[model samples]
Target: MAQITLVAAACVLVLSHSFLPGVKGTTFTIVNKCDYVVWPGILSNAGVPTLPTTGFTLQRGETKTINAPTSWGGRFWGRTHCSQDSAGKFSCLTGDCGSGKLECSGNGAAPPATLAEFTLDGAGGLDFFDVSLVDGYNVPMLVVPNGGTGQNCTYTGCVGDLNDSCPSELKVMNTDGGTGGVACKSACEAFRQPQYCCSGAYGTPDTCKPSSYSEVFKRACPRAYSYAYDDKTSTFTCAKADYTITFCPSPNTSQKSSQGQDTETTAATTSPLDFNSTMVYEGAFEESGASPSILAHVFRSHAIVGIVGITMAVRWIF
Candidate 1:
């Protein structure tokens, strides 16, 4: 009986480890705080494996969580005014992925879209992330790193709603000629000038200075990627952490909802992807001016080892 008990205890230890080793990936929780529905598109960096379900419809107030390899490098953006025809050809009026399907697969978002870009586990083991409007602007977005131990693991993004007052020359209007604007365009998108696009002779950062048009985006969103060379303050670094991406992340919205509340809406219904296959997660946080709390880890290895110890004691009785 003593020998049997020892064998069972060892088995329990092994089983516990099997259940815990699969949780090392970083988690991304995407929350939409806008008044309208948004279709989000994700694109992986070259040679990297694409995330599961590259595109999905996220209704207002809904949250989606995605687990990615610690070394994942990718960008995310929102597509507005999306629709599907009878053939299920999905497309968006702004920031379309051009896939003609709801799932973006490996497709990158078209220009004129606000981007949340990340490169995890890079040089010196630091994670770099930023909110880029260099491609253009379609919506206000923010990326907040949660629970990471590192210097300057703070939030990075654009909080301005540029569509409200986008310059007429750089505005992205609806085909219906609606009175209200839906998206904003970068000067490069509006005009193919090499200076604005940072191409030809202006390819280098020194020659590619911020133009008056880019300054408008900068003034509205100081921390965002206003132009191709807006890297001094736009880029942010951190250690390992879970990130939160929010669309239209106005502080007032968080104030009304009381800290990451989920008040579900409809017209377009979507649910979290399969947990077993995709392993995606969904969570939210209240908009806070205070520095992030909770040290940057979830289900630490020691915690799992503790579970193993507890299970071993139970199995010893067998």
Candidate 2:
């Protein structure tokens, strides 16, 4: 009986080892190298998110990190206003524009409001990341249609034709030989290229006619269309920009052991264990080694031996 109990205990220990949980660690580090300051945020697979504690102050080169959890994945993005001047208005002091000014060309205005979007994918895993400004100007624009109808158009359809007129706002202004309200007809004649001049009333030139604005916007803002930045090897010219994405693979925990040093391996390892698998093992062992039947047996045997020993002691004394 003693030997049987010892065997059972040894079995419990071996099984316990098999049931032990396997935890994985994942981490991500982001570096911001841009003139504009930013406060970055992070998202996770479980839908819980986090924001930077001190908020990143991107003056040129700065970095931060998010430590490991059960599983991790999401985007990192940020935005802030262009620095304002003493008069409490947006000012572009970074020399990002060609006219040595920060305001948009149309009546000292800025481009329509916009935001950046980024997407990331990993086959096995990824970690360690950096994003740098390719150029100084990463402003968002409200994409408008190509026609004279100033409705919101997709990025591809809004060739910077903010007003969505047949002759774009820019074309109309350039054609009228000035800015402001010049009639479409007169403006078309002034700005019409020889190839674009179809027999028309004025702004009705073939080139001035409505084409897809989305295509034009892509041509104009190819790099700015997406949220990516790369500082090295890319030109910072007005027409060219750059951004970057970097990551490291999460550690693998599914490796298997072989029989001997010279033994040949048979199969490839599987994906690292997940949080759900660990939870299942923990739940299975919640009442381990203390089943009701085992408890009752222990109590009954103790009671029977106590009663018999007590009776014998009393008779002997008498």
Candidate 3:
């Protein structure tokens, strides 16, 4: 009877492990398709265990992979035009984590930076994610699910280079005093108005409506978060999947749009690729063509067998 009890207990334990999503946790594959080098910064949410490395450098055409445990919540952004000073302090023009080192430690990206946010293993065991312009726009970014399923698991991002056409009032000029802009500041960051910032009496979603500035972003990246209240169009979810984050995803895409010399016209026609209104992820100019893995089918097959084993174990215990 003692030996039977031990066998039954072990069987149940082994079978239960199969129920967890991302059995080995999720893998975040960061790829750099931008022409210049990018120093990627990562910040885990408060109370969550930090990832192995908070920040790292990715040269043009380079790639890095990081594994995040189940239930991990955090945000990622690329630091552009980075330099290390004589004192060995590292910083960047855009998306700087303000840690003064390659590792962000625990600091979040500063405003006027593009961000990709994630909450893994949330309600219903789904992974929630979004590319947000609420802080502002610096670099073009895209988020693609590797092997995930859910109606909302499709691609989401602001792939347009908005800096070149950023409104003069909201433009963050290149420190080099070049004619071009490097980052586009959010209206909230630029004016600090209660309406733009969605603060004070305007804190509620009802009161805080989309301003004209946010509309510019919405027109460029329809699927991304344009403002504090853009949740309905921006947020996405998936279960049991890896992810690929690409900066400047399209090879043909340049920092400046190819739509002649008119900045306003270029801004309106951000990308040559047609955005599918359906939000179904179609192959892009440079998509990796990742499809949902057969693991889901394998999981279903094993699940049935595991359930039978668990039932037998319970009968034996009884």
Model 1, range 1-318, lDDT digits (tens) per residue?
787667667766655654464436667888887778999999999987677569998998898777776688999999989888988888898889899998888888887899999999898888899998888888868788887768778777775566756889888777745555677888898899999999999999989999999998787677788999899888988886788898876532212244455322110122211223221222334332221221123334445665776676667655
Q: What is the C-alpha local distance difference test score of candidate 1? A: 0.74
Using TM-score as the yardstick, the better of models 2 and 3 is 3
User: Tens digit of lDDT per residue, candidate 2, span 226-258?
Assistant: 111111211121111111211111111112235
What is candidate 3's local distance difference test score? Answer: 0.81
lDDT of 1 at 150: 81
* Best by the TM-score measure: 3
In angstroms, what RMSD does candidate 2 have relative to the true structure?
Answer: 26.7
Whose lDDT is greatest here?
3
lDDT of 1 at 85: 91
Which candidate, 2 or 3, would have the higher lDDT against the true structure?
A: 3
Q: Could you give me the TM-score of model 2 versus the true structure?
A: 0.26
